[model samples]
Target: MRSRIIFFVALIAILVGGYGIYDSVLKNKDKSSVVVNEIAPQPKKDSVEYITVWRTLNNIDRGESIANDALKREQMLLTDALDEGLRSDVELDFSPSTLFNRDLPQGALILPEYITRENDPGYIDLLVTEGMTLYPLVVSNKNLISDFIRPGERIDILTVSSPSSNLSGAIEKPIRFKGVTATLFLQNIKVLNMGGEDSEQKLKPVAGKSEDGFTTIIIEIPPTEVARLALAQRTMHLEVYRSREYEEPVYADVRNVMSNYIGIEEMRGSKNKNGREGEL
Candidate 1:
């Protein structure tokens, strides 16, 4: 009877151990068969903010007038363009006289600081208007009041020459007078520049030659009058007289060589060139 009891207990212990191993196997199989659906993160989209700015299409030099075709428009991020001092299409001045103040490489952004207007100090060619020609009138430094005259001022040009008359028409015999006569050559002319004032030495006297030093007064004139002005400048002495804006040109002539005197004689004993007493 004891032996039967021992065998029955052994069988029960074996069945229990086998059942535990089977249960573990079933749990592992169930865990392995289950599927895990994972969701991945997506990338962020770009910002919708942007701005339109001007850019150069080719290399531009300093003091050069920028043409419309030489520039290009592009859309850029507002945050990036604002810090660069760039100009937009509408904000830029497209006048014919507008010029670049600094050299710009190809594909460079067009900035406001690089621009120069008519009032800026630089070369004056960019300041000339369309359909007008720039002519340089060379005058002696002693004759011109350069301190009073400035660019953009209006002035009348006077020519002083000895009067001449044709005695014989066929022979073209001319008789010239000793006294000099002055006449208005050009009136209400616009002064574009006073040359040789630039610190960079880019602007020099228009006529490279002068006897007692000279200053080139650049003026704007019509194409029709260029020939006359050029001829007069070469043949006679030119003088400048400041005039008002929109002032009608007046016919003026100066023939007197000396001022009428009402003065006293010198107190000291001084001999004049003509062997007479010197008078003041």
Candidate 2:
């Protein structure tokens, strides 16, 4: 009987020892898991005190390669006051100069919007960019663009669609349609070149006249809007107006253009109203 009691005690002791070992193993595993999680490096937010950024000296044109000497670094307090596109000197290596793929005005912040993968060493091509296009327009009118507006000028493009009218020759009672529609197609477009040349960046008209009587104009336009320009050129005519405004770049779509002319639509509406009054 004593041996049996001793056996029972030994069995209980073995179970207790096994439970203790299992509990210890479980605790050690949890501790190891916690340590592994804590191993991730946490950023000490307070350590970041200041940020260095670059600024522009003069007005920079699109696709113009930014020289290392033109930019001056300035330190600002590290805070959320910075914009998303703004660039910092700390992130990029300034040993190699970067190019601005877009226009950057004077006294503007140097931002990441100017940097793209294609903006690399050497001359920038206006033709190869994905969303950009080269639109060539021949302006023969000496009164319009050839003489006054030269290369490196921003101009507004006006378009008139279906300007021709039909006439049913009844001699005394000939039928005639008023006119086509006119709208502002483009505003503040970059003028690349005038008369096959950069026009020497001359503000005043050149000395002599051209024998061809036509000046070929090349402008930088987006690929998407080129189709509309093509359609307008085919169905109607385009006029160029010089712009002196130096505002930020603006973009528009074909939906913004509408027929608000007072010639046809307003006249028809007035006639319809008169007819309704006569019925009344």
RMSD (CA, Å), each prediction: 13.1, 22.4
Q: What C-alpha lDDT do the candidate models reach, one value each?
A: 0.66, 0.57
Instruction: Name the candidate that leads on TM-score.
Output: 1
Could you estimate the TM-score for every candidate? 0.42, 0.39
- Any runs in candidate 2 off by more than 4 Å, and if so which? 1-62, 65-130, 142-147, 163-177, 195-212, 244-280
lDDT of 1 at 182: 64
- Candidate 1 C-alpha lDDT tens digits along 1-280: 9999999999999999999999999998787666333445588897767777788999998766668899998888777766775434325777645788778999998877678876677646456665788898877765554446666678888776654532211122223333446668788898766765553332232332334676778889989999998877766667777865445544433224333211122242577788886533
- TM-score, candidate 1, is 0.42
Give the number of the best model, judged by lDDT.
Answer: 1
Please, what's the RMSD in Å of model 1? 13.1
